[model samples]
Structures are given as C-alpha cells and as structure tokens.
Target chain A: MAKKKTSLYREFVKGLWDDNPVLRMLLGLCPALAVTNSAINGLAMGMATTFVLLSSSIIISLLRKVIPHQVRIAGYIVIIATFVTVADKFLAAFLPEISKSLGPYVPLIVVNCLILGRQEAFSSKNNVGRSILDALGMGTGFIFVLVVLGGIREILGSATLFNLQILGDWFNPWMIMILPPGAFLTLGILIGLGNWLNERKVKV
Target chain B: MSLLLLFLSAAIVNNFVLTYFLGICPFVGVSKRVSSAVSMGMAVMFVMTITAAVTWLIYHLLLVPFKIEILEYVSFILVIASLVQLVEMFIKKMSKPLYDTLGIYLPLITTNCAILGLALFSVLREYSFIESLVFGIGAGAGFTLALVLMAGIREELELSNVPKPFKGAGITMIVAGSLALAFMGFAGLI
Candidate 1:
C-alpha cells in the first residue's frame, strides 16, 4: 500500500517536471506557441485544455476495459472531441473575450496530441485515480510553461505583465517579441534552458 | 484575382507552420531529412486539400441544412480520421511506390492540427467552396515550404554545432525563428 501510494505520487510529480508535456516531452507544441502571445491568453488556453484533458482522462480510464483494442483510437478521439466541444462552448458563452482571442484554437484542442497521448499512454492503462492525477500534473506543467512563456513575451513585447504596466516609460518594447518569430525564439531558448537544467541535475 | 491573392496570403504572407503555428509536430518531427520532408509535405498537401474540400461540403450541405452546427468538431474530426484511413488504403491499392513513401505520414496527418486548422479557418473566414479549396492548396504549399526549408537548414546544421543543450529541437526552433523573420518580409506583398 505504501509503495502504491508512492508510485501514485510519482506519477503526478513526473508530469510536473520529468515529463513536462511542452518542455520535456514536447507533446503539445502548437498551442504552446499559438495562443501564448499574452499571459492571460496562455492562462485561459491552459485552463480550457486542462478541462478537456481531465474530463477525457476520467472517461477514457473508466472505459478502458470496454473500449475494444482496434477502434480504441477512434473511441478516444470522440471522447476528446466531446469534452473539447464543451470547453469551447463554455468559453464562447461565458468568456467571449478570451474565446474570441483563442479563436479556432479552442476547437483545435480536439486534435492536441497531448490529450490523446495521455489517454493512450497513461489513462488507458491506469485506474481513474492515477489517470486524474496524471492529467492534473501534466495540465499544471503545461500551464506553467505557457504562463512563463507568455509572461516573458508580454513583458518584453508590451512592457506589461497581465496587461499591467510593469516597465517604466524608458523601457522600449521589443516589437518582435509579440510576433510569430518571437514565439519560436522564446520557446527554443526555453527548451535549451530545460535541457541545460536537466544535464546539470544529472551531473550532480 | 482575389483567389490568387488568397492563395498567396495563405502560402507566403501567413504560413501555416511559421505564422499560425499549426502542424508544428510533424514540422519538427519529420524534418530531419530533405527527401522525407518533401514526401511528407506532398502527402500533407494532398490530404489538406481534400480535407478542405470535403469538410466544406459537409459543413455547408449537411450540417447547415440540418442545423447541427454544434456537432462540428466531432463530425469534422471523424471525417478527417476516416478520410486519412481511406486515402491510405487507396494509395496502397493504387500506387505501391507512392504508398511506400507516404505510408507512415498519412496516419500522422489525421491528428495534424494543420488539416483541422485549415478547415476551421475556412469556416471562420466564411470562405466559399472554391475559396476554401484554394486556401487549402495554398496552406498545404506553405506548410511544405516551411518544412522543406527547415529540413534543409537542419541538414546543414548537422555538420556544425556549438552548444550541447541546443542541439536538436532547440536549434531547429531558433532556425525557424530566423526563417519566420525572413518570411515576414512577404507581409507587405499581400
């Protein structure tokens, strides 16, 4: 029982760092680059994705036994699409501003390999409890990367954080930081930093 | 004239992979070699064009008439998945060499956000059927362009490297950043 508890904890903690979806595993790069121009957009996108990931993980974990082997991919996709639709509609109806900003990215969540990957690799094999923990951990990790990435871009590009004026008037905004090239450059550097940190950890 | 502009816009002015950030998975995953990148690009262009046409038909003819627009995501994904399966089987039956080249990438394309992104963007832009088709071709061409360019640069990058940490994906992404900046020059053209 103690061993099982420790394993469960590891499953959750692993996603936070060891197997981060964006940084370490590189599962969901599209949204990690697309909707993260601003910190708020990143936070909103992260929450919506977490909702889909959590819901689908639960459903897939429950249906793991019943869903057949061959058609399981299709089954998992349908489940993910349903949850994505719910998240999309919820955002559209309640948070119109964020929804508008996110645009088709909300629906595009249906195809995010991260959610499907978790279902296939973790949830389909694990129980509901473990799956939920995995989803939460992975979601948190994803959100953390997004917020940091977006925060960096926002601060540099607009001289603000979460839409607040952080830098003084003297600070010149780096216009490139908010553009498409900036997203690629920032993520590349972050990924390099992640690799550097991992190597240091291994050496120590 | 407008259609040509649309094509140019999707292909150059706003590249799907570079600008919109759709389909970064395969862009990074399969772009190690130029030969394979070319094959993957063609395969994606084929499916994307077909998906754009078919999804438009279903959205306009079936979903709109039935007022079942809420089922858009589910239905579109199902269509893309089955379409990829069918295309794979068809290729296997028809052309052996082509199938050998594109076999692995076809299944991967189903989950590629670019296909679905093209579909959704067409819908969002309120493009007509023909416009959507052109948009699809253009987007596919753009994706191919970006992938091939990245692959070329990466191939050269294999010879020279300085940093240990920024070797594979990290260096590739930074190269892509430079490419994106270059592509930005086309923004004024459209």
Candidate 2:
C-alpha cells in the first residue's frame, strides 16, 4: 500500500518540474508567450487552463473505455472544447478585464497542445484519481512558470509587479521585457537554465 | 487600397508569429530544415485560406443568424478538424505530387492555433468576408516567412554554438527574439 501511494505521489510530482509542460516539455508555448505580459494575466491564463485540463482529464479518463481508438482524437477535442467554452464564458462574465486582455487566447485554449496532450498521454491511460493528480501537477507547473515569467517581464518592463511598483524612481524599465521579443528571450533563457539544472542534478 | 493595406499589415507589420505568437509550435518544431519548413508553410497557407473563407461563412451565415454564437469555440474547432480532413482527401485524390509534398503537414495544421486565431481575429475585428480571406492569406504568408527565416538561421546555428545547455530550442528562441526585434522595425511601414 505504501509503495502504491509513493508511486502515485511520484506521478503527481514529476509534472511539477521534470515533466513541466512549459519549461521542460516545451508544450503550449503559444499562450505561454502570448499572455504573460502581466503577472495577473499569466495567473488568469493558468487558472483557466487548469480548469479545462482538470475537467477534460476527468471526462476523458472516465470515458477512456467508451471512446473508440479510431475516433479518439476527435472525441477528445470535442470534450476539451466544451470545457474550454465554459472557462471562456466564466472568464468573460466574471473577469471581463482579464478576458479582454487575453483576447481570443481564452478560446485558443481548445487547441492548447498541453491540455490535449494530457488527455492523450496521462488521462486516457490512467485511472480517474491518477488523472486528476496529473492534471493538477501539470497545471501547477504551468502556472508557476507563467507567474515567474510574467513577474520578471512585468517588473523589468514596467518596474512593477502585478501593477505595483517593485523598482523605485531610479530604475528605468527595460521596455523590451514586456514586448513579444522579451517573451521569447526570457523563455529561451529560462529553458536553458532548466536544462542546466537538470544536467547538474544528473551529474551530482 | 485598404484591402491591400490589410494584406501588407497582416503579412509584415503585424506578423502573426512574431507579433501575436499564434503558431509557435511549427515555428519551433518544423523550423530545423528550410525545405520542410517551406512545405509546412505552404500547407498551412492553403488550409488557412480555406479555413478563413469557410469559418467566416459558418459564423455569419449559420451561428450568428441562429443565435448560437456561444458555440463558437466548439463549432469552430470542429469545422477546422473536418476541413483539414476534407482538404487532405481532396489533395490526395487530385494531385499526387502536391499531396506527396504536403502529405505529412496537413493533419498537423488542424491543431495549429494560428488558423483558429485567424478565424477569431477576423470575427472580433468584424472584418468583411473578403477582408477575412485577405487576412488569412497574409497571415499564412507571414507565418511562412518567419518559419523560413528561422530555419535558415538554425541551419547556420548548427555550425557554431557557445554553450551546451543553450543549444537547440534555447538558441532558436533567442534567435527568434532577435528576429522579432528586427521585425519590429517594420512597425512604421503601415
């Protein structure tokens, strides 16, 4: 029983770092780059994605047996789209500012390879309990990366964090840190740092 | 002249890949080789043009009229999937050479967010049908341009590298950042 529990724990923990959807696996880079201009935007995008991922994983895992292998991809996409619509509507209704800033990206979640990749990879094969754990782990990792990235960009770009001034009067914002290029540059360096850390761990 | 401006703006001044970050998957995945990148770009351009036209029709004619705009995400995704499938079949049946050239890339286009993003942007902007079509072609062209440029750089990048950890995807991304910065120079064009 202990062994089984530990393995389940490992399943959940791996997604947090080792199999991180953004920094490590490099899945779902579009939104990771698009919406991370502000820390709040990143957090919002992450939460919305997690909602879709968790719901779809549950549904897909529950119906794994019923969904035919030949039509599984289509079925999975439909299920994902349904939940994405819910998340989109929820955001638009309650958080209109974030929704408008996120723009079509809320709807683009339907095609986020991370969510669909999870459905195909972990959820479809695993049981419901494990699928939920996996989704939570991946979602957390995604959110962590987004928050860090957004925080960095927000601070450097605007000298603020979450719209609050982090750097004082003497500090001039980098300006480029919040632009499209900054996103690519920052994410690139972050990925390299992740790889370096992994390499060091393996060696040690 | 306005339509021409839209085309130019979409193609360069407001490139989908660099500016909006729509198609980063293929921008990163298939950009290792210029040849395959060209083919993928062509396939995407073809499908995107068709998708723009079809999705516009479905939105304005079917969904809006029926008050089913809430089904936008679900319906748009389903339409894209089927359109990709149909286009794949039609190509395979009609032209052997063309099909062989674009054989592997067609299916991948279905999940490409750029196509879906184009549809949503057109709808959001309330662009007319012809404008949507022009925007689609232009976006596809911009995507192709970026992919090819990245591939060319990667080809050269293979020969010279400084750090072990920053190789491959890391370097590609930094290069993309530089490219984006350069592309920003075109901001004044429009």
Candidate 3:
C-alpha cells in the first residue's frame, strides 16, 4: 500500500515539473503558443484541455486491455477526439465569446500531442486512479504556463490583466507583445529561464 | 486572380508555422539540418495536400449530408492516421531513395497539427473542393519555405555563440519570433 501510494505521488509530481508537458516536454506547443494572447483565453483553453485530458486518460486506462496493440494509437485518438468534441461543444454552447476567440483551436485539441502522449505513455500502462492524477498534474502544469505567458503578454501588450488595467497610462503598451512574434518570444524566453533555473537548482 | 491570392495568402501572408503555430513539433525537432528539413517539409506537403482532398470529400459527402458534423474531429484524425500508414507503405515499395529521404518523418506527420489544421481551415473558410486543394498546396509550400529558411539559419547558427540556456529550442523560438515579424511584412500584399 505504501509503495502504491508513493508511485501514484510520483506519477503526479513528475508531470508538475520534471516532465511538464509544455515547459519541458514541449508536447503541445501549438495550443501553448496559439491561444495565450490573454489571461482569460489561456485559462479557458487550459481548462478545456484539462477536461479532455482527464476524461480521456480515465477511459483509455480502463480500456487498455481491451484495445488491441496494433490499433491502440487509433483507439486512443478516437477517445481523445470524443472528449475534445464534448469540450468544444460545451465551450461553444456556454462560452461563446471565448469560444469564438479560441476559434478552430478548440477543435484542434483533437490533435494536441499532450493528451495522446499521456494515453500512449502513462494511462495505457497505469490504473485509472494513477492516470487521473497524472493527467491532472500535467494539465495543471500546462495551465500554469499558459496563464503566465498570457499574463505577461497581456500586461505588456495591452497594459491589462484579466481585462483590468494593470499598468499606468504613462506606460505605453508593447504592441508586439500581443502578436505572433510575442507568443514565440515569450515562450522562448520562458523555456530558457526554466532550463537556467533547473541548472542552478541542480548545482546547489 | 482569386486563386492566385488564395495561394499567396496561404503561402506567405499567413504562414501555418508562423501565424497559426501549427506543426511546431517537427518545426523544432527536424529543423536542425536543412536537408532533413526539406525532406520533412516535402513529406508534410505531400500528406497535407492529400489530407485536404480526402477530408473535404468526407466532410461534404458523408458528414455534411448525414448531419453528423460533430464527428468531424474523430473521422478527420482517423483518416490522417490511416493515410500516413498507407503512404508509408506505398513509398517504401515504390521508390527506395524517396522513402529514405521522407520515410522517417511519415509517421510523425500523423500528429502534425498542420495536417489537421489544413483540413479544419479549409472547412472553416468554406472553400470549394478545388479551392481547398489550392489552399493545401499553398500552405504546404509556405511550410516548406519557412522550414527551409529556419534550417538554413540554424545551420549558420551552429557557429554563433548563443547563451547557455538559450542554445536549443529557446534560441529557435526567438529566431522564429523574428521570422514571424518579418513575415508580417507580407500582410496586405495580396
């Protein structure tokens, strides 16, 4: 029982940092860079992704034995796509504004490597309980990064955070920070900082 | 003239990699060498064109007619996966040299969002079948253009002194940011 608990803890903990789907693993860069122009958009995209990841992991884990080895990738994708569809429809139905802002990206979650990667790597091997923990951890990590990226861009680019003015009038917004270049530049620097911080901690 | 604009817009003004952020996995992974980048880009272009055609047909003929459009994601993804497998086999048998160049990247193309994005974007734009085909070719051309350019720059970057933390994907991302900025110049051209 002790060993099982520890393993579960490890599975969850690893995704939070050591194997973060974005900052480290770089599994889902498309969405990480695409939808993070503002804090709310980032949060919405992250939550939607989390919903898909969480549910899909559970389903795939439960069906691991039943899915044939040769077609497991296809099986996992269909499962992920179903949850993505549900998330997409839910967002469109309830959160039309954010849904419109997110655009095709909501449906594009069907292709996000992060969800499929988890099913193929973790969920297929682990039990439902452990897989749930793993998905939540990874989803949280993705959310943290997206929010940070969005916050930084929104603040500098538009002088707002979560739609509230955060900077003074004297501080002119950096228009480039909210554009495509900004997404690439912010993620690039964040990743570098992550590596630098990791190295410093390791040296200690 | 409209077709020309569509092709140009898809190829440059709105590059898939730079503007939409699709296919970033291979963008970062396979861009270390120009030769490999060219091969990967070609493989992607080939698959993307075919996917654009197939997904359009499926969406219109089966999904739209039956009013089961919600199945778009599921069917599109499955189609891409199986198509990649079939392409891999066909190429391996047809031409040894071509397969050797693109063989490794074929499987990876299955997960490339650019493929799926191409399909989705074509549908979203409500492009006619022929227009979708043109958009596919144009987007593929744009992707290849960007990949080759980045690969060339990276090959040169090998000699440059990048900061310790920013040596790999970090530096690549910064370069891509600059590239995106440059590509923005093409805006309003078409």
Candidate 4:
C-alpha cells in the first residue's frame, strides 16, 4: 500500500489556492461574514486572525510529538485561544476603534474552525516550516476573500471602497449592502457565483 | 424592568444565530431534525448558562484582578472546555434519556461560537451576574427557537425540489438570509 507522498511544500502551497479555507473548504464563515461590511475592518480582522493562526500553527507543529492523540483538539484550541488573547489585547491597546468595532469577534476566534482545522489537518502532520507555510497560505487565502468581500460591500453600501469616496453623489448606497442581511445575501450570491464560475471553467 | 429589557434585547432584538451569526454549525448541521434540534438547543442552553457564570467568575476574579486581561481568550476557552466536560458528566449521571439525546451535542458545544460569544458579550458589556445569567438564558432560548423553526421548515423543504446547486449549505444560507430578514423585524421590539 505504498503510495507516493507529496512534499511538504505542496501541502503548504495547496492551502493557498487549491483548497483555500474560505473559498473552498468554507470552514470559518462566521467572522468572514460578520466583519466584512467595511474594507478596513475586514483587513484588520484578517491580519489579526492571520497573526493568531500563524503563531498557533507554529506552536502546534512544534508540539505535535508531545501532545496525546485523544487530547489533540483540546490542545490545539488552548494554543489558539492563547494567541487570540494576545492579538485581542494588542488590538485593544493599539487600535481601540477597530477593536471596539470588532468587539467580541476577536475573542470569538477561539472557536474559529479554521485555526483548529489547520492544526489537525496540516500542523500536526508537517514540520515547522511547512506548518508556517500552510498557515500563511490559508490566512492569506482568507484575507483575499475578506478584502474582496469588504471591497464589494463597502463600494456598494457606502459608494466608497476603503473609505475614500469612489462614486459620485448620484449613486445611491444600497443600505442593505452593509447590514447583517447584506452579509448573508452577498455571501450566498458569492457562493452561487463561485459555483457558477467553477461550472463554466469545467465546461471550458 | 431593565432585566426584562435585557432579555427581550438578547432574545428578540439581538438573536444569537440570526443577528450575530453564532453557533451556526449546529444551526445548520443538527437542525435537520426537529427533535434533534430541540435536544441540541437544550444542550447548548445548558452549557451556555454554565459558561456564562463560570467565565464571569474567571474573568472578574482572576483575569481583571491580576491585570491579565490579555488572558481572557485563553481562560474563557479553558473554562468552556471544562464546562462542557462537567455538563456531559452531569447529564450522564442525572438522566439517561437526556444523555441519549443531548450527550453527543454537549461535547460539540465546546466549539460552538455562541457559548463563547455569550461569554465575550457579557464581559464586553460589563453585565452583572444576574444580567449575564438572564442574557445567557435568553440567548439560548432564541437559539432554540431559531433552530426548531429552521428544522421544521427544512423538513418541509425536503419535499420541494430545490435546485441541485442550492441543495445543502446553499439553501440553508438562503433560508438563513430570509430568516435574518425576518428577525430584522424584531429590531423595533426593543
């Protein structure tokens, strides 16, 4: 039953595009949907999540040998929560407004399936370098979608992308584009659009 | 009166699933069956109530006093994990039927964001012990109501021919979108 083993580099590279957490796996949509109303907030959340994710991945990868098999998920969660705390405190102290706007979401990252998923799926199996790459890839992939979502919502909702007025006054903002429902509707359409694009690509 | 207002706000005006997008995993996963949804909701409610009290004590008595507010996430998570464990044992020993239905879901609650969100919200709002407890209960009830209703609707949706692409998560999300739209109507209730 000896099959070929893909290199660690491939594992890391795969998460970036081929199996992007948000775009493909749809592992962690809570924060992806919640904080993406504004371009800046989305960016901040993405960076914060990436920091915790990368740090936790490194730690979990390093501790892969010591941690017991049954308790792996619990251990990964503890590690994730610890980094989330660090990130949350840094945001609260350095960027109070963004921290306030994000609110409980920073702490809520502890339960984010993405961090836990990476720890189980990639970090535990790979070396430190590979784990770091995997986390970076997934985090960047996540940020890619976040930036796009934020850009779309911000542009449509405020007639501005990244808070600089893009459209003239003649363009009316779809107030719906910035609220909770907008997050659901936009993501729903995006998923459908994503499937449509994939189907088209398959046809081509 | 203020307590009632808080309950109404958490339960109706600011629903955990509909408004905040918390505990969506089970909301979508276990909500396929009405009975399972009810049981899962009860399990979540039970764990969330305990998480509220425990996280409150941990944050105030330990983290704030020690100026280790940075440890909030770490501590809350540990507390929730242990809380789920304690809940599981208590459920198993207390009632066999309950353990049968809710046993599986209790373990799953450890990762459910709603419980964590409740802890984080109470801490962020600086809710008092009583208010936090009430908030926990209300949020749990709200979660249960949404899950049950969604399960009922999905049961009916099984008969209808939803397009293939929108079958699983796609339809659930669109339904959640409409449910979210419906819940928005409760904004005026506050």
For model 1, the stretches where C-alpha displacement exceeds 4 angstroms are B91-105
Model 2 misplaced stretches (Cα beyond 4 Å): B90-106
Residue B85 displacement (Å), model 1? 1.2
What are the Cα lDDT values of the candidates?
Answer: 0.92, 0.91, 0.92, 0.85
**Tens digit per residue, CA lDDT, model 2, B8-96:** 99999999999999989888988988987887888789889999999999999999999999998888888889888888888788878
lDDT of 2 by residue, A78-112 (tens): 99999988998898899999999999999999889
| Residue pairs clashing, model 3 | none
Is candidate 3 or 4 superior in TM-score? Answer: 3
Evaluation by lDDT, superior candidate among 3 and 4 = 3
Residue-level lDDT of model 1, residues A89-175, one tens digit each, is 999999999999999899999999899889989999999999999999999999999999999999999999999999999999999
- Please tell me what DockQ candidate 3 reaches: 0.86
TM-score of every prediction relative to native: 0.97, 0.96, 0.97, 0.91
Fraction of the reference Cα-Cα interface contacts (below 8 Å) that each candidate reproduces: 0.78, 0.71, 0.79, 0.50
User: Candidate 3 — what's its lDDT?
Assistant: 0.92
The full ranking of all candidates by lDDT, starting with the best, is 1, 3, 2, 4
Name every residue pair that clashes in candidate 2.
none
- Model 2: number of backbone collisions: 0
Error of 4 at B159 (Å): 2.6
Query: What's the distance in Å from true for residue A178, model 1?
Result: 0.5
